[model samples]
Target: MESEDITIKPADKGGGVVILDTKDCVEENLRLLGDTSTYQMLEKDPTLQFMERMRGLLEYGKERGIINEREFKYVRFPRVPVFYHLPKIHKKLQKPPGRPIISGIGSLTANLSEYVEHYLQGLVVCLKSYLKDSIQILNQLSDFKWEEDMFLVTADVTSLYTVIEHLQGCEAIQYSWQCTLF
Candidate 1:
């Protein structure tokens, strides 16, 4: 296919590339977004609203002395996030499927998100199930005391990304944060 009429994306599973018809790529993306329970089509961009909400949250932090004046001033409105997809070539679908990716590198709440992640990093690291990398897993396996009846198992949650609702996610964060204080 000609470059102009095709879209090139990295494969979701193994390392490689998948070149697909641009129309097909667009349709696949739209189909993923068409999941009403997970996503909704907005008539207008929500950048301004998001920026304002972020500002209000920051202002509240400032008022409560949770944030200093310098930090409040330093955190400015950020650019909106960009949405794209990587082709899930490993899937056995009729048409080429894609995994949606909403990049929030410079989005309105990006800084706040980064701050929250940093704050929670300590707790996450201390969790018994936390795995830093494949090497860590290998180290654990090397020290494992296997029993005759015991079987090692692994699992992959395919729908993990779309399974949790936003409110549920926030509640989970809040719960984690509260638990950390004790």
Candidate 2:
């Protein structure tokens, strides 16, 4: 396996290609965590209390009928997070934002979020379909009908995710699930 990233491209015709340094990005991440250095330097073994907390959450889900025993049958231990960055390219920004969101597919919270991941993609598709009609998105329209006297307006939701409380979010999920299932 390759340990480091290497790029070979055509000769930098007048202007050169800037891969951009990852050190600044790494420093930003460490700063956000208030750590002295990279997160790997501080990574430690999972504590017994951490295991207990995860087990408690799983048991609570079972009690609430949110998850079945079958789903947890093959899950024994939580996995540690393996962090990787996906480079982000923006049209207007001269330099890459460089600060991309790190996704932990193999982290301690991964198993606990396995079920949530099931909805993440489906929610995106469903939301796209719903907004397609309401927002009058051209390509997503199946059968577009236009009226002469119609005026269209788009609404913007500000801080919808950040402002919503956990309980409210859960209630919204529960209500939507019930409506879809029944």
Candidate 3:
């Protein structure tokens, strides 16, 4: 397949997720949140619902003493994300599916997320440690002890951000803090 007509997605198991026909309809697919039918759902709220939600979250934070006046001042509204896709390098006869990344850069949510990350840094297992660079991982891997007849296996999960159940993951995090021994 031609480069414009094809892309790659990580396999749920071990192979590549190839799209059979890309033809000339890439723009619709690039918007990973949803297709044309979904875009129809985007409508201006006359009641200022989005602002209300933000206000509620901020109020809740203030009540819980989680956010100070200084932090409230620091928050800035985030921009709507821009979407783009990078095609896969290998394989033919299929177009790779692209997923949308909700880039929270320069947004209030991003600031809040970063602030929360500071607290999570002190947790039993830091998410950042698991997401370290390849060099660090390779250096650590050098210390792995192999058994006499051992074989190494590796796998990548597809669409992890979209696939994970967020609420369940939060519960697991709570469980890690409560039941698991560090």
List all candidate RMSDs to the true structure: 2.6, 7.6, 6.8
TM-score of candidate 3 to 2 decimals:
0.63
Q: Model 3: per-residue lDDT, tens digit, 26-125?
A: 6535455465533345556333565468768887888899888787666666665444444342433244444444566765467767876776656745
**lDDT by residue (tens digit), candidate 2, 89-119:** 4322233333323465655566656767676
Q: Using lDDT as the measure, what is the rank order of every candidate, best first? A: 1, 3, 2
What's the lDDT for residue 136 in model 3? Answer: 80
Could you tell me the C-alpha RMSD of candidate 3 in Å? 6.8
The lDDT for every candidate, in the order shown, is: 0.81, 0.53, 0.58
Off by over 4 Å in 1: 92-94, 159-161, 177-182
The candidate maximizing lDDT is 1
**How many clashing pairs per prediction, in order?**
0, 1, 3
Query: Whose TM-score is greatest here?
Result: 1
- Name the lDDT of candidate 3: 0.58
Displacement of the residue 104 alpha carbon in candidate 3, Å = 3.0
Angstrom error at residue 147, model 2 = 5.1
Clashing pairs in 1: none
